[model samples]
Target: MKQLLFVLAFVATGLFASSQGAVKKYRVGIFASLYLDSTFTGSTYKFTNQMPKHILPGLDFVQGALMAVDSVNSNQPLEVMVYDLRSADQSLDKLRSRNTFDSLDLMIGSVSGAEYRTLADLALLKNIPFVSATFPNDGGVTNNPFTIIVNSTLPAHCEAIYNFIMRSNPTANLVYVRRKGTQEDRLASYFAKYNKGSNGSTLLKWKTLNLNDNFTQTDLIPHLDSLKTNVLICGSLDEAFGLNLVNVAQKIYKTYPMELVGMPTWDGMKDLTKPEYKDLSLFYTATFFNTGTVAATNFTKGFTDLTNGRPSDVAYRGYELTRFFIQLLLRYNTQLMQHLNERTYRSFTEFDFRPVLNSTSGKPDYFENKRIYILKRSNNLVSRMN
Candidate 1:
């Protein structure tokens, strides 16, 4: 899903800048995969003036950031510069040669994988605050206090899931339904780690139900408790598995009280709110969700008017990240790290950047957002439970 990202081209715009002032101008760099090179063949447009579906998310992110930039009513000019990692000849050395980091106060990227790693290293070297807007994984980044992961990691999700289960369903029959795979094992271990760390007690001990890749309803029904609520945490990011799990769970829900919590990837299941899943008590964690605030409502309207369609969560995330971090840079200036966990400003999601320690080094490698939203959908209505 994160592929097809190397597409966006660099675009920069002027923000109010001042050489000397209490609120001086700050340069901000936004790196995204726009794939500008592939769009044109020496002058003729390849796609014929139409944006591809694959590139829309990144572009939407840019649009959201632009909207936030426009909304800024301050003297502290944010000289925003956008870079397309998918450029024909773009490289870290090329970017470094430009000596751009010398002027940048903050850097944000909706990038992932190797691109994320390069930028993260640059942030570490320059002591610049790098806001990773969309990537979920840390890419093995360690000993880097400059990196801030806005999208919480998988371990963070597992911890949040465990906390939700123990707090809300202390006595519920907890069953971890996972397909046999390395990823599944890793996910299970995360929950296990969290369970072990919680006061050295496995209060939320779960009955593991390992199934084949092509698991059927018969494989799950035997483990579910009909007499009590069965809280099943699906330990897989596979959408196919999640769909099947939901289908089987729905059938079982008719006779048993069941709640199925899915991984973060399940957020893209648009059909969850359909008639079939209307009464399904589905749970999932996400970094952000539309809270229907006046600002959010206006943003939705504006986004629809601009794109002629509804905006995705990435769009909201882009706006929130840009607006939030810019305000932080403006307010704290060089001392933004001192108040990294402050919850004073919010756009859609609440970010609490807690330092993530590297296991081998026993020191903070990076900061990640630990705050999670347990969104529950029941009776055709969705609400954030925590």
Candidate 2:
């Protein structure tokens, strides 16, 4: 009878252990500059002093995505810990003092370039995955095996813009107008390469304009009047310069018609809709959500319902990032870490993070949703060109 009791006790203990093991929990760390001052109240502002009250819709979007995933997967309760890194006085020391890094399975944020570098180092040391919802400005977190960029980089954007222009106007002459900064210069070089063999022959021309000193309509007016090209590409994000370019192009369009093309920075700028830019018919490239497709529309509605109708770029990014990660987790199950290292998530982007080495000579790779939208500005209204 004692032997029988011992066997039963062992069986009960094993069942309890199994049940406990099935209820696994995960903690995700969200480090961001969400605590901005109330002085800058707008859709783009990332921070506020109101505790959980005035936090932007982007935060809600991210939190909602995590919550939705957690609701269905009760086995693993995901606990998201947020770090408000918005103050100018904020430092890595404060982040370390919080001891928030101790139990983190993954880290996501739109930290400053410097803070991103620090977080990259910490993530590598801790062996945790890191995702950046915004552009980090420092050419991505290199050497960090666990870091993933949710937003497409500047180079990818440039490539997409180049391809779209080449396809749309095979015979059109292309002229690139750029500033003298590192980012601008890099894009200029990229355009040079693409224009060399982009279409049948080299039909693109390059022109450099000093954005600091000699950046006025007068400087580009002569070129515009003389050029046979009708398409003009601006490689700078300076809103002031963009406005000037648009103004100049509009004036020149009276006699010489031209099309202004820019990168993703052209989106959401209220200044572009002013009367001065009315004649500047602009075309630019943006991500899938910005294009307003059926899938994107449904997702946006779902996101708006969760966040009280406040939306922005970060909100869309958070939704897509969370959805992608959740899909990856469900598909790979326990082998997520392994599969990530092996570059298995090809559907996420055309260029899988793992298989594609970040080099120039490899496949003409681009991020997964390379669907570029040609946005045209007609009568100061922006619409997607079909």
Candidate 3:
């Protein structure tokens, strides 16, 4: 789903430089993929102001970005350029050939697969900070210091889960419950990375509980212990698997003393408020979370006034990222990446973009937001665990 990332390539020519206090005019590119062709029928440029569903994600993102641009209290000319990926006039290939974003200083996107690879290469070649907005995987691009993946990866999620589990009683029974899938293998491996050579032998007592798609309460209950708190780590990226697992767990949770840990993808299933999930305390990881703040309240009010609808999570991300990065541009300019860890410009959600190094050169392969939030949902209420 994160493929065809509607990227907003905010640019500034040549160094995009500015002194500590002094500022100059800069150009910002909003490279979004609106899929405009699907919006209309036959050959017609005429379109209504109302947005189609296909373009809502990109539109919401761009709206938040534009709002952020307007919010920045700067007199300097920060030119905003928006590009539609599916448009004939500004398609990805067309814009690339035209060198529209060749001199970009930073690119914020949720791009993945071939598109992500292409954009990451371009950012590396041009020395632009490619900020991947929500693509969880890196797409195997390495040795490029300019790449910044905002979403925490699977391994990062696993690590967060492991760390959270370790906080419980070391004698607690840890079950890596999952279905038969290739991704499940990777999840198990990631858990093994932390489980191996740590905390003296198996004080945490780890075990694998492989379940089928039609797994029932009996399939899970046998592995769980009544004495120790049963920590069931749902080791599948599949939502169906997670839902099925939850359905089963919720039935047997009262007897087992359960704490169900879920994959990062579980963050998307918003309707966990159903009665089935209430008795069971479900845990998942996310890169973004807002308990609500003054700044967030202001943004929500401004966005509702601007769009006449509630802003999406992506919209908030766009605003927070754009606002924070622009502050960096104003403060450090071309040296933005040099001081990415600077605590000066804080966003509503915390971002910890740590460097991932290349094995050969020992240099930064790319940067990734290693900060993962473990969230809990219980009794139709959700809260951050860490």
Candidate 4:
């Protein structure tokens, strides 16, 4: 009887090993700017007291992705590997020389500049899905269907802003305020190109107010009309300019019902939530937003429990996108590209992915998320208006 029990246990152990081995395992690569070498030296700490501000975003993003990988309680086998692109001993050629990406099923990057472009190109060459997690620009990687840009481009943001204006308050008095600079002028050009696509001559009429050093309410009141709703578009990305506009608007908007729309960068402006700016109605565009859904709420709790702080937008993107694409990788395997637009995993934000095409060739450039959320702030509280 003892021999029979030992034989049964031996058979059960063999079966468990067989099942574990039979499961298909996928190799996933996550590249972020962790700056590991700079922070650590042979297990010794470099900055003992506090982490540098430059490395915080990358650390937070990687932490979120690690949480996501742990939360994936599926039957499929997943092997995740994280590479620090900003490490002292790291470079694109060094990574490639080691054949680090040879067996990768998918790659995700939280990097920009040359690293981003290299990964995108590598994904194209290898026929693997390389998810550009944070960089807003396309980085000139054209005709690559394997590249998926999670962060919408500047032009997409401009289009979303124009669409919001036309749909929300088309007949309202439109005023575009900007400060003169190279980047600011370029943004103005983007708006002009997108705004011209609408039908009718008088359908979209906007007057530009270029703010200077001597700018004040006396210069702004001329464009605002007290009789109708004044929709002010802050066309520049300057933080000081945005704050000045808020001060001026607060003084004038008590008389006029005004809504101030800002650029995508304004989403990161925590100062807008202060008590002094509470009364002003403000709006801005962002790629990802958590509105306290069950999943999002749980993620926040889990993140806070782990780090004792709330997760930032980049962290949330890392968690959501990692979970999302890994699920797809397990389910669809190598054919994930065919279902790029499918709404399978509903995370914090509903991603609206559309194919971007090359201008001259008219072929598929890459997949991009065109949807931008317009968040509204009033009375010291913020909510998604769209």
Q: What C-alpha lDDT do the candidate models reach, one value each? A: 0.80, 0.57, 0.75, 0.81
Taking all chains together, each candidate's TM-score versus the true structure is 0.91, 0.69, 0.89, 0.90
Report the poorest 10 consecutive residues by lDDT, candidate 2. Answer: 10-19
Question: Residue 303 in candidate 2 has what lDDT?
Answer: 56
TM-score of 2: 0.69
Ordered list by TM-score, greatest first: 1, 4, 3, 2
By lDDT: ranked, best first: 4, 1, 3, 2
How would you encode candidate 3's per-residue C-alpha lDDT over 28-115 as one tens digit per residue? 5555666655653543333455555766787777777766877787655465566566568776577689896765556776456777
> Candidate 1, 124: how far from true, in Å?
0.9
Tell me which of candidates 2 and 4 scores higher on lDDT. Answer: 4
lDDT of 2: 0.57
TM-score of 4: 0.90
Top lDDT hit: 4
Q: Residue 56 error for model 1, in Å?
A: 0.8
Clashing pairs in 1: 7-34, 7-35, 7-36, 8-33, 8-34, 8-35
Query: Cα lDDT of model 4 overall?
Result: 0.81
